[model samples]
Target: MSDIPQERRVVTAIPGPKSQELQQRRVAAVAAGVGSTLPVFTARVDRGIIEDVDGNRLIDFGSGIAVTSVGASAEAVVRRASAQLQDFTHTCFMVTPYEGYVAVAEALAELTPGDHAKKSALFNSGAEAVENAVKIARAYTKRTAVVVFDHGYHGRTNLTMGMTAKNMPYKHGFGPFAPEVYRVPVAYGYRWPTGAENAGPEAAAQAIDTITKQVGAENVAAIVIEPVLGEGGFIEPAKGFLPEIVKFANDNGIVFVADEIQSGFCRTGQWFACEDEGIVPDLITTAKGIAGGLPLAAVTGRAEIMDAAHAGGLGGTYGGNPVACAGALGAIETMKELDLNAKAKEIEATMKARLTAMQEKFAVIGDIRGRGAMIAIELVKDPATKEPHPEAAAALAKACHAEGVLVLTCGTYGNVLRFLPPLVIGQDLLNEGLDVIENAFAAL
Candidate 1:
């Protein structure tokens, strides 16, 4: 059905001559601040494989950091976006409104969690969506303080950087961030100071106490969080944690915001990870997979909260670009037609089973967590101590890359090997990638 071969093939060494040349060019042309997980130059990407310039077909487990959940070359996305491209590239939606943008907004209203009358504003990246969400929340609640969790990652913008928890790489040296942003502990089950069973109640109580004593719940505008933490070791908060926080927000009149940028769009088995706990956020920010592979993001939320922003208070020159909107429509169509949510569940089952089995063999796997296609394994030196093994994670990823299997590592400690294979990837190819990962662990 797909033209791209659903298999892994290594014709030359990883980052072979052509990719090496491109890396050199990238060094010259690209900013040093811009970093890439893998240096292989892509010639084509379709379904579950990324073909390099050297003709190496690597089984892709990164999905361009979970942006291609509907596959890089899904027919619907290509057909609709291509049609739009031939007509017009950009009129700047604010300058001259377009049907495509409105259509996308309507679709997001229906697709995102909650049946309440909703509205949406599009943006160019996850960070922009998050920033706008905070703006909208503050406007609606008429408050200034914003609350985020320990492992949460919102975006790279100054406001988001202040909201983000990690310091190195993201927040390092980028100081004097926005004010009124508060950080609270996340109920990370594996690394919780207390046992997993106690993580939820303990963290929730502590967070609520902190908010009450320090920020004053009355002054808090929003409680923003990722349903499943991304780029922070794919940490899934302990059970009951989200509901507790949501209850607090509801009781305190604080707008609850779900930063589903990396965990939405059917990547988490459910349409959005918040659905897992039946939490209806006042606002939800989305990107990464919203427009297939196109750069688009949106803040979809309760109509009342969304409308709190005055007319012309929110928008971007490139927000909801016609072509990107078309891609989003196509992507949503593909998601429904193909039943990608079910596929994501299947992917989760397969990945969890395999990773669990590998954990039995390799004690370095401290934890295997995440939902559906957004899975990861945290690496550690000893199971007892649970000391992060970032070096091993890096080494294993490198080995997988060398063997024509593309993987990514992420975490606060940089010790997580995250797997975000395209949902359309064949089972055989998926298993092969796992095999490569297992072999990498074995070699280590």
Candidate 2:
């Protein structure tokens, strides 16, 4: 035999033998409401790849839905977390504060955008960060109404659901959402109503005017938006739009909140997407990739604004879990040492080149957009009409999966394909994944 390491496929199908068995067992043992993104059962994972129980290896373009930026099972993250586990687990920061928690908070204060004095509070997920940001905004502005944009997704909690724009999956039947939450149109260039190409500045001004006129800015506490909308389709506000909105918020005394949950931590090539336009939010919420693979989110913002809440109003039992903090500390250090921000730029370059090529070759690709490593391709039935091709997206994902690559689809119409590959993904692996996508599109 050659010296190359053996590549094995013991079972017949993708899930093989053990995964299907586990699925049955899971169905019998757990609530049917619990869900999964893919059918494969994870056995182990490393940088840019996942291994199912049956030993099938797959490239991870989704990056746990943009969570593990350094890649899964990062060496530094695992090391720090393992060491912290040996020391102690949970003391509940509310009960007994720890150094790791403080370290992470200090890091955030220093790292997040803006030169203004700031503070940070940690939570378990992006949703919690969003909810807390709303609370702080309301308290600081002494107002009742919170303004969110169309295609925005905050969280599953009652208040966040009210603030979120999507309805079917997140807000449907979850009724009677919190009060004083209103929605406005996002600066979505892909589906501009007036058929204006690259209408960023005009869109922002129009949106601000309509919102202020309708809601009477005095009643609005905050205007929360994603620097680059994530689940809503990797939508980036057109140039000149973000700066205009920031000015409008400042003028109206509305807290300008950047929901950077999916766009922060160098995912968009900068520390935060807001930095791309030199826009500093009054409050910024981040999560998904902050702690490598661990669950830890944060609300980092202007000191005075963040301090609006009562001293005891802002924490959770596991708000700053020591283990997650340790992982975050490691994640931050790793980003600096490895220069992941620069790496993110490189990743973006590669994706843009390859995806641009794919766009030219495939008529289904209606638009190619995103900043840094967070890229997406919107699919359409016809370039002239710009009608979403949801079936084409589904078929493309299926074909790519069959050919040993994992891709994900997003967008309100379910026609955009997003790429959130780990910043640490090897160039060869990245190219391989793209090749699979190109082939799938060609077949279609």
Candidate 3:
């Protein structure tokens, strides 16, 4: 359909002939420190499968870290982007505003959950969107401190890194982090506080109390959170936990900002993860899948809060690239046409059934969590003991890759396997990918 080829494989080994040669060249020319998730360099990809340079075909469960939700190489996306390219490429929006940029902002205002008069600002990446959100929050609330939770990942930028929780990889040697960025415990049910039964509002409340008591809520600009924690683990925060935090922020005049970079664009069954709880945040940061893989991110919020920033205070050199905006328009249309929200629920059904079955048989699977297609499996040394088994998780992922599936490992301890398949993936392909994972874990 539309030019995206149906599933087909032409190569043998994953890094077959051409890919290996290129890999050697890449090793010599490119940075060796950059890690490759899949050994094979991609020649082409569509829907759920990646065709390596060597012609080997592998099912893609990573979805480019949840960027291409509709699918890899979506036809409509390609066409719309190509059409826009023919007309014009870049004359930065700040230099010369265009309808495409305004159109995308309009779309975001309408799409993002809120009835209040909302405004939007575009950026080039998730990190940029996050940074801008923080800037706006500080300006709006006139406070210095920003509160983030444990296991939360905002981005890799300096300020975002400070807001991010993990240490080894994201923060390791990069900091000296930003000041006034506060860290609090998330409602992680699996590793609940001493006797806290199930991660609930009380767990979140405890964290809030500690933050307010230590940092003083009056000094806090925003309480930033990922409705469903992404890199930390695909752990959905406990029920009522988010609402409690949102209320606390409102009561204290703290800006409630939802970092929906990984959890937005129907990846979490709703248009946004925050929708599940009916929580209306003051500001929401979005990126990744917003433009069907192109680099575009945004901050959408109430008009007054966003306007608090001076006219020149917020913007980027390439904030709303024309091509990216076109791609976003196409992506938005594709999501609506395909009813991706419904597709997400279908994905959850498939994932829960498969993962639940695997958990029933494998004692290593300590937890099966997430919403919609944004699912993950937390591995353990012993299910009863609940000690994280990072090595086992790495081994299982390696096994799955060899068996023709591409998955990713995340979480603070690197013991969780996250699945972020394109929403357009065929059921058969999804099942086949899950089978690879099952076989990998079962064999272990």
- Which candidate tops TM-score? 1
lDDT of 2 by residue, 1-444 (tens): 011111222344766688889989988998976677567888777767777887777778899988889877788898899999999999999998999988998999999989999999999999999999998998999998988888888888999988877787778888998988888776788788765465687788777877878888899899999989888889887778889888989998999999999999989989999999899899999989899989999999999999999989999999989999999988888888888889889988988998888888888999999987799999999998999998998999888776657788888888989999888888888887888889899999
**Residue 100, model 3, lDDT:** 89
TM-score result, candidate 2: 0.96
What's the ranking of the predictions by lDDT, best on top?
Answer: 1, 3, 2
In candidate 2, how many clashes are counted? Answer: 0
Please give the lDDT score for candidate 3: 0.88
- Better-scoring candidate (TM-score), 1 or 2: 1
Which runs of model 3 end up more than 4 angstroms from their true locations? 1-11, 194-197
What would the per-residue lDDT of candidate 3 be over residues 1-444, giving only the tens digit for each residue?
A: 233344534447665778888888988988866778876887678888887766677888889999999886776778888888999998888788889889998998999888999999999999999999999999998889999998999998999999999887778989898899988888888878553356777678788888879999889999999999999989888888999999999999999999999999999889999999999999999999999898999999999999999988999888988888988988889999999989988999999998999999999999999998899999999977789999988999888887778899999889999999999888888888888899898799
| Candidate 1, 43-62: lDDT as tens digits | 88889999899999999999
Q: What are the models' TM-scores?
A: 0.99, 0.96, 0.97
Clashes of each: 0, 0, 1
lDDT of 2: 0.86
